[model samples]
Target: MTASSVPSSSASPARIPRRKPRAARIGLFGVGYHVYWGQFPGLLDELLAKLAVLERRVAATGATVVNFGMVD
Candidate 1:
């Protein structure tokens, strides 16, 4: 059986520690550009707006905003 076919409670899973990148700044972006969601300009606008706020929020937490990744 494939992994997805296994019963949820039947197996012990390995937990990997999520090591955060040591870069001074990181920008997270959605997959809208590569998908049909980017067809509408409004979609990109909204994405940029949200990313801008997110960058500020992350920067407030001490991490720098290298780029919001919203290129239009």
Candidate 2:
């Protein structure tokens, strides 16, 4: 059989199936000693600053970061 004899269905332009949209929800939390804040002096601020940087980096990767910082 020649190429012309082939059925058109094999080469037909059927609508391509589309995939559904993907969604992801992520929660990011940090922990530290709340009681030590007074004794440590600036410990709370240090830990929070670090957590903020981490959250920013993670968010940059397209992930939704729910910051639950300073868990007492």
Candidate 3:
């Protein structure tokens, strides 16, 4: 059959609804010895600071970040 002779449907195309993706939950933790903190003086502070930077980066991704802090 010729293109001009073909029949066309009057109905419009259906559109699928879109949904937002769920946020992710992330947990962060660090480990350090108390003895090392005393020996190194600023070791604990430096480690905590680094952990904070990591937490900020993760949270920026629309995720819930929980920092458990230094573990022993």
Best by TM-score: 3
- In candidate 1, position 43 carries an lDDT of 76
Give the runs in model 1 whose Cα sits over 4 Å from its true position. Answer: 1-24, 34-41
How accurate locally is residue 26 in candidate 2, as Cα lDDT from 0 to 100? 68
**Which sequence of candidate numbers ranks them by TM-score, best first?**
3, 2, 1
lDDT tens readout by residue for model 1, 1-72: 899887899568996876975556676764465464556657766777888788788888777767638543
Better of 1 and 3 by lDDT: 3
lDDT-wise, the better of 1 and 2 is 2
Residue 4 Cα positional deviation in candidate 2, in Å, after optimal superposition: 20
Which residue runs of candidate 2 sit more than 4 Å off their true CA positions?
Answer: 1-19
lDDT of 2 by residue, 1-72 (tens): 998988887586877676965455568777877789899998888888998999899888777889888886
lDDT of 3 at 41: 85
Error of 3 at 68 (Å): 0.9
Q: What's the TM-score of each model vs. the native? A: 0.46, 0.65, 0.70
What TM-score, to 2 decimals, does candidate 2 have? 0.65
